[model samples]
Target: MLASDVCPGEETIAAYVARKLARDERDAFDSHLDTCSACQELVAAVARLAPSQSADPVTSIGAASTITQAAAEALRLPGAQLGRYSVLASLGAGGMGVVYAAYDPELDRKIAVKVLRHARAGDQLRDEARAIAKLAHPNVVAVHDVGRADGDVFIAMEHVDGVTVRDWLRTPHRVPEILHVFEQAGAGLAAAHRAGLVHRDVKPSNIMIGNDGRVRVLDFGLALADLEPGTIVGTPAYMAPEQQRGEAVDPRADQYAFCVALWEAVAGRRPEAGGRRPEPGGRRPDPGEPGTLEGVPDRVRRGLRRGLSARPADRFATMDELLSELFPPVPRSRRWM
Candidate 1:
């Protein structure tokens, strides 16, 4: 290869293609691969030429030798077609799959296409599409289509041009600004609850704040119509007690997570500092006890406390109710007729 074709991390390609890179190193490479076109082409070439008989776990690419499944999926080059969408570039990857920025010729618009990691996840992907498809709210990411291509299941969704709420919170923001973003996200959650679906995962990273000043709730991958008991899912820092215990969960669980995220954003600390899960049958924090949230307004603190209650029953009946508490409505003025 020419010197111009060489990338900084070229040495790791053999280990990466052979699936021998340490977990952290591999993850670092994955992030690097997203933006490094030269590295991507190098990795794809190495995978194609590497021996197939290696004992390492093999992630096939069109009947080729071993490669990390995530790498294989993310290597879909520009101009590659997944169904009718022309892949432009990889957006990112998560536990479930890699998201790509693509163009739909039929609609003549840019879209996000998430290609799942496992073929068996097709059913779950369909489930997520169905859940989000039910809501037409501005605060929710819209799902456009779901289909399979080359044994991979994918969901095409609205391409959001903005930072995640977690990223948005990196800079210091006013209390009102934080609440404004979260209220819109909460509205999306409320809509999902009304549609008989629960977004099992609600964290700052899952919420997006578009450049247009719109807040949207995305990634309903863990959403479910029924809470299957004994199945624990969600980010640990934001999971409610019920979710931690692998017990059946409802919309209130999402309320708990929302409060945790909002509390962290406003107070600069989570109500539960360490992402600790309260033990089953553990004593709920005394509602009257003064906690870490010192400077927060009385009403906002009270609202967050109730939402973070260990027992779901102690939480606001619905996401709408919690939102009202967080951002109460102003009373109308009475004028002389």
Candidate 2:
């Protein structure tokens, strides 16, 4: 008997293929594997051994198209409906869970929902959900509801329709536009820091620019209330040296990431990761200023340099400090409204 014939389980092969191909190009292999019973059995065996913990018992399907094989055998779970809301479509998937765009029939609004894929082996979902719920800020995406359904943990949050700053920067941004983003991001970080939180992940991908010209910081999955050691949960490209080393990090780590992102936007190329900048034509710019950014202004370049300082002490102590220097404290009533 084939693996499918021997192993009888509810987890389907189509879901398995979708999860596996989540990051790679979607192709015929996924479709064929979905219909092959032998392949399905192999997938089931492998899934049992894999470290997957989905919030829903059903498997995740990536941005791949449907094919005969997968379409024929894939099991379709009911769309998630919690309280007065119904999940409409998948937005994206993170390390531990997936985010969805959901409709609330009672309020007649769309909300963002994050459901845990698998409960942590040690920690309860309630604990994590409560921690996240405490965060409330205009700039930070708000957590409205959190709970479990059919053993799957979920969180309903305010949805902001937007594109990530990183995606927006794939094309060049004008100097003013870049500065606008930095200013708003700095303010958001300042608010979170004041509440005794540090956003462990501070990359372009985590910063969003909405169609309404508002900037909102997204994803607090890696955020923590207190600075601590031993959590390795930030994106490698944007992580501070201390974070990568698993050392205790403070708000300065976020400043470092902020500077790195600013540099990428202004400099038009990623700064060398190890810092030092290869002597830059044998003479570094004045202590807190960069020599080049092609088109970025002097004030913005200076700020970027300070944020990317080699030593944490050299960086701004708080996002507020950075924001004050970039944008004065006065409220932009006209622009904001």
Candidate 3:
């Protein structure tokens, strides 16, 4: 049931598929699982073959996370080994899986390893990897590598040592600074759009701010193409009307989410449910419900209002266009030399 017993050309992982072992022995196997990336991936492979394993949670989501934390502590990843990277510490865990700050000996740099929980085919993983690999932009967090480790599919990504856009908004910032940050984020989305990709999820939490003062759009996990209608994807408050209606989403959906994030950043609150968009024929929506528009410029507010329009057609055609409306380039006169 453990990697040690089976790793040396013995019975395969299939032989240990969710096998019941003694409590002490299970704990020991879990310890081995912590360091052996190969074994971890093996577990993931079996999980794919038997999806029911994940459905059996010991308790609620929060309790599961607590148990996961306890398990991690017991393993204590210090000097922990993986395929090609040494795990330094656990950065955080989300619905998908756990992420660790690791050191890549070959690259001689720090990287983030995201281990996805679900089982996806190798071909699918490779295709997604290829697409993400092509998206190389300053504003987009780079995906350095992707491969199966042991049994889990892990993504090696460029680590940005900083806070999320959500947390960043909690700190005080000037209007210009806010606009600048959002512009950079918009650039990332624009890049994705040009590559024929729509970032279905564009909440503030998906945006990362590096300590180097660079704003990057992260997590393309939900950015899949041709999602069937009725696919409920994205955060509710930040979701576009079309998305809520279960219609196929496009770049305009991202525009709507961007507007929501910007609005929250400025107003310090999300747009209420049933809130109407700023459309001429639609019911007039209160632009002041989230409180005074102090420090929010008229141009910025107007752009946000339009982007937040319920109809996708009413919103900005592209992320770049939305940015241009919010920040038109200043004309420069050249002196005759």
Candidate 4:
């Protein structure tokens, strides 16, 4: 049976899991599982609900013993209502929450719905929504709505049809192409900085390239209006020194992460991971040092080195400044000449 032909139920799933289903039925269910996300989720939930080996297996197939409760709700299958939007399918999930591809009946359009993990995370989700909603740049994902549903906070935003920069980098790209994508993403980050908000988490995975060929910076879950000293946040590999030290951060910190991502894209490895450690006093090794950025151009290496500086002050004062360094403007000829 194909995915469309399968209508999974608690009993059917339980029978399949308990090995009570006939060979043909099991084969058909297996075929459906290949493409049915809802059924796949049910199978996972069944696994979780399974009793220990010492205990008798679930032979009876009524409701699958707790399958219809929390597990079912967590699945958020198609037609499930989340605030004003109807959940179509789950796009992905992370530490923050699960992102669902949903449809807005009133607006008659599809949107990405991020259901935060913590029910009490409404304040933070609202903050993120407000911060992103204020940014009108083409490189920033647009926020459409934010609300609470069934004790969960959800943010509705633009549904981008594309892959993360991390995935995009899986395919080899020219230096110019890499710079072009990051330039657009940097513009979005710069726009956030201009609005007095700091994206505490900026990494390659947080940046995406849409099917329309536009690059966008997204997932401002850690963003905030005011920096609180001693509050550490962000991915460790891409974090600036200050961010890792629990010190207050600014736009320059984001610049450091952007450079790290760019460096990885160009050099095929992170600076530290490439076996280059910081010099004494915690400063990064000079870009001009031998064996660093071997094939990269001098100008690009210089900009990346500065952006990855240990001290925020040593890095570019603003994202726009760093972008300028990475993609310098063509000089105009003098009219008199």
- Of the candidates shown, which would achieve the greatest lDDT relative to the real structure? 4
Clashes of each: 0, 5, 6, 0
| Model 1 agreement with the true structure over 136-240: per-residue lDDT tens digits | 889999988878888766778899999998778889989888888998999999998998778877988889999998999987655522234585555655778
Q: Where is model 3 more than 4 Å wrong at Cα? A: 1-82, 119-122, 224-231, 273-292, 333-337
Residue pairs that clash (backbone atoms under 3 angstroms), model 2:
53-117, 53-118, 54-117, 55-116, 55-117
* Model 4 stretches astray by more than 4 angstroms: 1-75, 118-128, 224-231, 276-282, 332-337
Work out how many backbone clashes candidate 3 has.
Answer: 6
* Residues 185-290, model 3: lDDT tens digits: 9999999889877778798888999999899998776652223457464555577878866788889999988987887776676655244443443323555446
Quote model 4's TM-score. Answer: 0.72
41-152, model 4: which lDDT tens digit per residue?
6564554445332243344324544665635656678899998899998876433456789999999999998775543344665656676677788998888877878876
lDDT of 3 at 264: 73
lDDT of 2: 0.60
Model 4 scores what on Cα lDDT?
0.73
Q: Which is the winner by TM-score between candidate 3 and candidate 4?
A: 4
Candidate 1 global TM-score: 0.73
Q: Model 2, stretches more than 4 Å misplaced? A: 1-49, 52-78, 82-84, 117-136, 150-152, 224-229, 273-291, 328-337
Worst 10 residues of 4 by lDDT: 52-61
Task: Compose the digit string of candidate 2's lDDT tens values, residues 1-337.
Answer: 1232232233443344234333122223332332354443344333332345344424432212322233323211237575556878766553445567888787888898765544442254455556667767666778887766655556788898888887898787787888788788777888778876677778787788887888888776554222234745555445566765677788988987777777777766556523543242212233243356766655666676676665677778888887766666667568655
